[model samples]
Target: MKVLTANRLTNGEAVWLAGDHSWAVTLQAAEVALDEATEEKLARAGTAALLKNEVVDVALIDVELDSGALRPVRLRERIRAAGPTNRRDLGKQAELQIAVAA
Candidate 1:
């Protein structure tokens, strides 16, 4: 499967394209495309956001549903999904943990 990802222009936060055509901060909310044609269509739609400076580094990435959870297939994409590896208490992982704790 494929998913669209980008960094929010205002905060540089990693975001995924949701089913509603809105950007989501969590991968779980991402809209997954099962074929290359759908991937290309989503990528094309993302171009407008890029041109508007609403996001940057927009691209499609390979992923799979592992144990009912969506996961990036490559190392680079994994890092992007999890946030900076050097700091465990930072970024998306940390934010998610905090949310769960709450």
Candidate 2:
């Protein structure tokens, strides 16, 4: 599968393209394109978001459903999704851990 991602303009938060043409903060909520055609359509929508100044650095990324969890295929994307690995106490990973603990 493929997914579209970018950084939100206002806060620079990593975001994914949602089904309704909106940006989602979490990958689990991202819209997945099962084929090249759908990926192209999503890329166009991402371009629109960029032109409207809603996001930047928009790109299509390969992903897979690993044990029911959607994960990015490349290391760079994984870092982007999880946040800074050098600082485990920061970003999405930290937030997820906190949520799990609660």
Candidate 3:
């Protein structure tokens, strides 16, 4: 069982850790929205499971608590992490490929 880990910034942005062990922020547009319909579309498109166990914090949604201290709203998608596990194995994509040994 391979794992695909990524770090989402505090600004609602996502960065993927590539196979080369490098950080990249080149994800699709639909992956950043909090809309339910958008998430469904991503699931149909086979890109939903990429963000499993991902916690994203909001940088500018701080609010004053009862103690007169500011705290972040902390928007996150807990349910998205536990979606279908029947998708393709992203980690072994190259190894499962078909090579012509001519």
Candidate 4:
């Protein structure tokens, strides 16, 4: 499977293309493409977003659904999903952990 990802131009935050056709911070909210047609559609949307200057570093990421959870195949994408490693208390890492704990 695949999912579209990009950095929001305004804040350089890693975001995913959601099912509602909006940008979302969490990878879990990203719309998963299970086939070529969907991947192509996501690619087109990513290109459009890039041209519109709404985001940068747009990419289609390889992913898997592990026990119904999203998991990026690459280490780099994993890091990106978790946010900056320097501050564990910040970004998606903290956000996800907090939600789980709550």
Q: What TM-score, computed on C-alpha atoms, does each candidate reach? A: 0.92, 0.93, 0.20, 0.90
Better candidate number, 1 or 3, judged by lDDT? 1
| Model 1 alpha-carbon drift over 4 Å, by segment | none
Per residue, candidate 2 scores C-alpha lDDT tens digits across 21-92 of 889888888999998899999999999999999999999999999999999999999988888989989878
**TM-score of model 1 vs. true structure:** 0.92
- Point to the candidate with the largest lDDT: 4
The models' CA-based lDDT, in order, is 0.91, 0.92, 0.31, 0.94
Per-residue lDDT value at 56 in model 3: 38
Q: What range of 10 consecutive residues in model 3 has the weakest lDDT sum?
A: 57-66
Which of candidates 1 and 3 is the stronger one according to TM-score? 1
The alpha-carbon root-mean-square deviation between model 1 and the true structure, to one decimal in Å, is 1.1
Off by over 4 Å in 4: none
Which is the better candidate, 2 or 3, if ranked by lDDT?
Answer: 2
Off by over 4 Å in 3: 1-5, 27-102
* lDDT of model 4, residue 4: 100
Residue-wise C-alpha lDDT for candidate 1, range 8-58, written one tens digit per residue = 999999999998989999998999999888888789879988998889999
Candidate 2 lowest-lDDT run of ten = 20-29
lDDT of 3 by residue, 1-102 (tens): 111234454444434333343334432111232455643443332333334433232111122232652222332321122222354332222223322222
Candidate 4 local distance difference test against the native: 0.94
Candidate 2 local distance difference test against the native: 0.92
